[model samples]
Target: MVGARTLAHLAATAFLTVAGVVATPTTTHADESSDPDAVSAALWLATEVDDNGGIPGMVGTPDWGLTIDALIALEATGADAETAQEITAALKSHVRDYNSYDAWGVPGQRIAGATAKLLYAAVITDSDAEAFGSYDLRQETLDLVAGPELGLEEGRVKDKVDAPSVDSSNTFGQSLAVLGLSRSGGVPQSIVDFLIDQQCSVGGFRLYPYAFGGGTVTGDCDEQGADAVLDPDSTSMAVQALYAAAEHDSAGALEAADKGAAWLASIQREDGSFGGSGPTEASNTNSTGLAGQALRAAGETAAADRAAAWVLDHQLTSANAAAASAELGAIAYNGESLAAAQTDGIALFQRDQWRRATPQALLALADVSLGEIGLVDVDPGPVDPQPTPSTPGPGAGGPNGQLPATGAPVLPLAALGIGAAGAGLILLRLSRKESTS
Candidate 1:
């Protein structure tokens, strides 16, 4: 019920408290990029949720969509051996049946595209056979998710969904599909092409090409005639996929990504938190996690700094706080908003925690770290072996401290994403040569 302005003020106050310093007005701009350590911490916090997002087919009493989001963030961060290995282990146990619609035996078969999501992580991280299932299963799973016969639960029927309908609402699935196929090396280029084509023009992506609803109240898509405006969650996922794919170098991809990043920046609250669009009034931890990564990716460190600071400030230091809160694991933009909700708040520990793997947030943080430390020529694998000070072990520094910065931002000449406004013209011309390689 709180408006955006109130949310901003609330965030500013809360940030000042937890950050232990008042953020200068210049520090609040969208153009600033976050230091790698803050990005790492954000992703690190999100991974704690992934640790408990259930062990796949077993049905993790608590849902795992948010955990999955965090996991994707982790992957985007390009974490080292230890971090990746830990995530890989979790995926292996809970995601062995990569294609099961209700692998966890959950009520909603298509809530967050769980099947495609696990596969994305599996393929990217190279989880073992048992964890990822047979290659044939992988292909079949992709077919099921991408094929025409989309599944819709009969129980919900008209009340929740239509029959035999593809739950395109699975934004996570769509983006992960793109990420998995692109990373798999075995999947045909066409699948990747199809996924790319699904990107909405309005600087972000949606769950499906035809599926709608992304916090839009206009009852209409954007002026570009996009099927729908971008959702913060899906848009962040799309950026992750494109960045992984290095689509930024391709025609229109960079522009699209840049616009998507810009759109994300536009929605950030004054306090640096990002709220889910529409009725979801609270600021989403998952959304904040991914948005931080996207901004970090685009070299917008200032935005990342503010956003990451806000997330850290709001993190429920207590146990199970996010889980018990009415707003789920999502954080509010500021203290007043948090206080207003505390009257009915479940528990302190349950405040900042919510359901999600947050691999993407981790990936985002890792990427920022890699960018800062100049850790190029790296491959995806265990986070520790990757050789970072933050490798998380006896000898290595904690997840924070002593990370070397790369000195200067390397702005890709090519614009990001598929939007029209950002250097798209040049990128399209370059794509003619780039795609061939």
Candidate 2:
């Protein structure tokens, strides 16, 4: 006879398979007429917002960084008007002036990266960045560039000014600065030069120039140590910045972009995904998405498509319906991690992992390059009149709901004979554990 545990396992598996298949679209065509992947991913993102418009992170409060990520993804997928308006409304409340230490709960005495990302989001959504929430995003970004304390020599943008000895900004921040400034008019040549200086010998960009332990600063264009990692995320953002600057006829930016693209192509794994170094050393969806966008921007179509395919393969689709639960629209970080999460339950770590991974993956699925995300001109005609809620509406909630804690069984025990039930459970557990471990 089939044990109770075996029956339960079979029931959960059957339910998940049916639900996932029903929820996941079968088509692979990516045109405006039919983009199932993008649409499903975007809908999943909408459920992640908290009651205060923040994404759940940093002690359960709203995180501006994650918020910007979702905004970009939603915009890329052409998400519903209601969802878009709700997110923008929440984002508007988080805006702060140039003097504030905190903007959208991202704590830094000076907010360069957060402000720059907001500026990018504002531009792409066709909102008046200059007049967004009483703070002019364009002017604020320019302030970061021109501010004597925040702006370093040779056009380097710092995260904060009080700690001059500390290197507050990394390649990611610098890249965003370049991208934001490029859109406002043009990035200064000196700033462009400073960004180019961050590239390592391998053509990949390091997340930070300083070593972690003693925080020893490395020389420009030099790798810090054996531990000094070349990150795909930083490299991807750098490529986008360089590509944008090159459009302005910046002399060395194009060459730098070409080298970065070549470096990315060289490092791609046999499975078509890209991995990171240092802290983020795993091959996952976020890194792949960033690299894919960079590759696309550099006109590396074949490599970009390969990376995109890898991302699509990792998504919770109907093909894997029988194995996964009701996470139909969500994209897993990677196959291994997804299996682990499924078996052990989706913990805080796994939830945040998907939160970061899903939006980034959406970029690749939507075929939108990072450079094109905020750089392109979008005309969102005629704003719809939304009803003002006296109290917080459904937009305000924790990252609960939508995502299932466990794959509840949805089939009858009688359907799966005793022997079949026992075998299936054993196989499922073994396969899932093997992939994760």
Candidate 3:
């Protein structure tokens, strides 16, 4: 009997031939040993990690945030258990650095997003969030929540340390806080409420509640009018958090998620790709992957599949194989990046962009949302089901609570295909149409 994987490979080959994907043929072949694209992408991220135990920032500094993202990607894909544990230990040692503006500080400037994200990592790993290393990440996250003195923004999550910092309190961070607290300690309704308030009357979420330079926490999405910029990335992140919140029965979270999904659907490009805000206004893998996951979470199957197809196009696989073996399975920043990588291996300066893009872009290929983190296994095994209705206790699930992986492993065509395109490129043109929502 032809194995299931082989059968899927044959079907995928047939689909590629019928669709007539355009690409330049190349002698380079995809690394077939790499089964799922998620694992391949996560392993590629592992290759980029340095002795400091994290991905590099501008000027070769260890970027704690990107390191956390890589860790999350690894855990989500169930790639390497030992590496995930190593990242956890490293981050735990740098808990103060990860959550604070300065390693040495008087008042101890804590970053709300960082704290929440760390807490989330602990929750997924079944580590003690209440006491991670010397810090109690769960309590610390709660401390970052705005108080009643802030009036309408009382429940909002804020850095409260230095406003000008990168990856500070924004819709993205707020979503992290919600997700971090969702399954373990449980999120407060008010914090969830604040996230809900971020939604515009037009159905999307903004990056920040305040103006770009202004840090007063003023500015309502509704009042922005012509200036109302709805970000696909931020909206998608918020939707991921809201889906988890909805899973927990947080009031109005599901509705807000539904509306956000609708806005994403409205903005999706003709080819099923998505764009980011401000500088990243063109079709890109990051936005498309994030939006695709949100759409899948919202039950938009066709939209999500379209996104997965677009991301596969940018991936360095057997289909669009790079000359170097190291570059395979590393997703590019965009189509241009993919094309450039085909001719010139990803440049040294360009590696950082590719590093950031791969993990997020892997989401579309994974077909799982960060909101549902730990719920599905990347390489799952048989497990006994839960007996009670209450949430799984710490370590009950592998990360969030390990359930058996659903569906078959994806065969990202950067491997082998049924038909021929060009010598050095393999662009996918799936006949799967945009389904009526």
Candidate 4:
């Protein structure tokens, strides 16, 4: 309805600093050697992360959620290991803040997507997902799952708010939940079934889970009227999650995952790029990077490689960026963004676009798929039991001193379905190493 989505009401952040006051790392383009484009990208991300391990959003707010996305991207490429692990450790103190903001409706509201993502992060980071932060993320996810009593579709990971509210477990949340659980202890068939229910006959998945007609989340994607729009980002996430679920013997996961990947392939532009619905209608790196990962996960190697090529075209390589410019290796939001950067450089205000774009696009460049990702050496279990949390708790202090009202939509930067990924790649390697150990 409105413009794209919000991180600080909108996305991106500039190089090294925002206005000279913002502190960033000193690592430059020369830090990492191999995979120059991706290494430089990781270096740039490391600079953006503060000692506290937070990445500021549009308004210079501590973007706890986006920080996780950055860490996932960094780990996926196996670059900046120190910074990634340090930030992962730092986030333990801010778990309440991140969970509340990205997951929404904390204290009372137990949202599946929110909780699932936190579980996803904990699992990927190799933390005891069963005992992270103030809540047991794994248990929270299982508890919020919609049951036969809720009158909603069974096995669906729904948002459990205080009052009886509509299940807000969108396609993205459900997919992430499945991925998180797939590692924690295998996903349930009903969970897989609920995910399948969201896929349209055409193979694409919708964002809102159901196409509402009379204010209720009723009817299938095809049954809905003009409002029934398919989201590439959601479909991408679903495809990857389904691929993972398939390993656990979910009946329809493999079929649905393949169809979802096929639908994404069918919609790609001639340039091998994908775009999101609504404000992100143009082929952009965020959507394309996500789609590329899904394509590769589905074994659509050629399509994924093509998608990566399109994504590379948008990155600010050493050739395009000034030698001293901190923005080198950063990817643009789209062709228009690349042109703008080439014409006038990445403006200070436009940095958010670069920050948000780089991580996901870099993942595509890395050519890593989600279904195969396993854990790394993030170490498991909780950090030294956080301080006896204050009134609203740690991170509730926010960038200033306020939290988004309970039930805020998870529409901001990295917290969105698009930004939160990297499970498959890390899991692929770590889970295997874990087996041998």
Candidate 5:
């Protein structure tokens, strides 16, 4: 007769115990003098950006979404003004009519998630969201939510512009829409309600409401089916949105955020990592970063610290520099994929995965919470005339600027022994791995 939440927490504890993960101190006390991981990761991201200021994708093309993620990381880590200026200028050049596309020449309707991410970045960087590169990012994001074709009946944000028939947008997009809209000005009550309704009874969130079989009814969340897989990534993002909205006096926002944070804490592996319920079922940096930030935003400091420690332990630091070579500071998606990429010379699939993982991991290392990033008040002003070195002061790391090792034990994913879910969950494939918020 155990409740679902209790069952989940018990399962997590059992998984951790079986995996031999020894819990570390959840309290983090590092300062600028002691922590260089954040700065090093920021510098690594700066190097990844091309001359044009966009982060290179798997195919070596400019990806605005990835660039935005990197920018957020840079801001979180307090990167040099010149570095921020160069990247923001580059991001500004790519602004389109209504939204910023993921990459140029990709021919598809504007992605609501991408637009929402850009708006959030703009606000944090103090750029004019209402007038960035001749486009009003704030207005455009609002339009995407208000448009009859893109917005669902009860204020849900649709995934794509062309797919008018599909009413329910993915939870990632919905969470971003809520965060962006709330930060830009004020989020509508209906929009907030729609996102809240997406939470499942188990306290987790499904990536999408509609069943994946393609014959399900439009805009439904009451019934659970094959498509209703509880995803850690979506749940984390939803927690972030609810926390941000709660700051604006939104009713039930804080309560919902607490529920989502509890779910994340309950599901965390002994190694302090998280995995999605779909394609990304293995513990990886991307899910950990998202969940960590959400936990911090919700004031779940113990869970947040554990998640951050896991990310730091897995990063390519001086301890692992010999193994990583030139890839130092780049956070791998997972140890298995990193090994494969090292043996196979960075395949196309691994390119975007690393690109997305590094910045997210950096955010955790920097101890930057989602609520803090959204509330950045720095005005986007002229770039600093002089650029400073990426290296931190003495007591920080060594010449290569590697982070000081925390001596935390590295745990493998296999130890958990929580094999993938049934085919019904795996076959849905609705949740594809992508760059994060």
Candidate 6:
């Protein structure tokens, strides 16, 4: 009889081929062990903040979504004080009036789900942790979890905006709320309890109690909608938020994390990459990154490494004429093609006195590799020494919880996918609709 893992591999292979995304061998034959170097590199890169103290989004812009994710990544990397302080400065600048109602707590751009993402950043960042813990953000925060009565199906925060009603329609928003409030030092246990009650059996989370039938999601593209179902991306983020809450308090949080981790592992491609479910499924770097993080947290280091390595390789090479002609120097996400020039530019970037990508890759690689060092027990030789970038990608949050949004204040959330920590990426309204990978 095929093992569960083997069965999952077969299913994933079928899924990928049917979905039309390439599942290359490099992405498949993953290095199964903890990548201490990768983790260190990614984490170290987190500390190399921009002048504004924020990680650069794909377009080299500062955005709150990246800010929150960057902070989370910084926390994971274990950055030092100087680095942490930069993160704090950025957070302090943007979080002053972090009303959940606004996009990045600002008006104009009503992003798909900025409310909870920014709030989560504020709750976790070093500067406003105390305020996050103590402030009566109930009116703003509670609306996502439940009605004041604390029910899952109905929420207190109703989006006044006509197009996207907030109340219960926004599960992503609600998940962020649960994570932010739970991680916030000051939030009451009642809030955590409310979110927990909504967990689904598949180890995934639902937007709201009634929004999805099982509290989690399943099925193909048609049924799930654009953001309808729970893929590794949303599931990992939701579980990470839950894990953060569990770490602070709650014995069951670990158990929930374990289940989520298992579910994520079960979905790993034969080569070790994880793809979001459905007819439109494509492997996502952000999802892979988060899944690797969740698995690492669950003590599945070998499995985590496999996923991490795949993510690293997915970084756009910027090679090839077609790729060279296209936008260059940006991180290749979702299997983006690089222009030959862009690829060359990245190569040049790599050759610089400070090699940015190499180190960033190393941090996550280290975390996964180190965690699995005992599992693999083989030394790959001396790692290439690379200087950190002048401005690192997201993941700049420090231990004290100080993480600034990318250096620019009030930038659009569309730049980076999301911040490093567990905050989801912002899906900018890009004209080109790439596959989810």
Query: Using lDDT as the measure, which candidate wins?
Result: 3
Candidate 2 deviant stretches above 4 angstroms: 1-35, 97-108, 146-153, 161-167, 214-219, 223-228, 321-324, 344-349, 374-437
Candidate 6: tens digits of C-alpha lDDT, residues 179-269? 5554443334544443454455666654333333232322222334444455565565556555554434343555665677678777777
- Compared with the true structure, all predictions reach lDDT values of 0.38, 0.56, 0.62, 0.59, 0.57, 0.40
Candidate 5 wrongly placed segments (more than 4 Å) = 1-35, 97-109, 146-152, 163-168, 213-220, 225-227, 340-349, 374-434
Q: Which stretches of candidate 4 lie over 4 Å from their true place?
A: 1-36, 101-106, 162-167, 212-215, 375-437
User: What are the per-residue Cα lDDT tens digits for candidate 4 across 298-410?
Assistant: 66778888877777777665555443244666766666667667678877676765676777676666545554443322121232111111111011111110111111122
The C-alpha local distance difference test score for the whole of candidate 3 amounts to 0.62
TM-score of 2: 0.71
How do the residues 162-270 of candidate 3 rate in per-residue lDDT, one tens digit apiece? 3233323667667877877776657778888888777898789977675554556654677656665688888888888887766555667777888898899888888
Q: Which stretches of candidate 3 lie over 4 Å from their true place?
A: 1-35, 104-107, 162-168, 380-437
lDDT of 2 at 73: 77
The candidate that wins on TM-score is: 3
Residues 64-128, candidate 1: write the lDDT tens digits: 33333334344444433455556556545544232222333322322224444555556545563
Q: In candidate 2, where is summed lDDT lowest over 10 consecutive residues?
A: 428-437
Compared with the true structure, model 6 gives a TM-score of 0.57
C-alpha displacement of 202 in model 3, angstroms? Answer: 2.1
Candidate 1 Cα errors over 4 Å, as ranges? 1-90, 93-98, 101-112, 128-138, 145-166, 186-200, 211-227, 247-252, 316-437
TM-score of each prediction? 0.53, 0.71, 0.76, 0.74, 0.73, 0.57
TM-score of 5: 0.73
Clashes of 1: 75
Model 6 stretches with alpha carbons more than 4 Å out: 1-50, 55-61, 79-83, 96-125, 132-145, 148-179, 186-190, 206-228, 248-254, 277-280, 315-331, 334-437
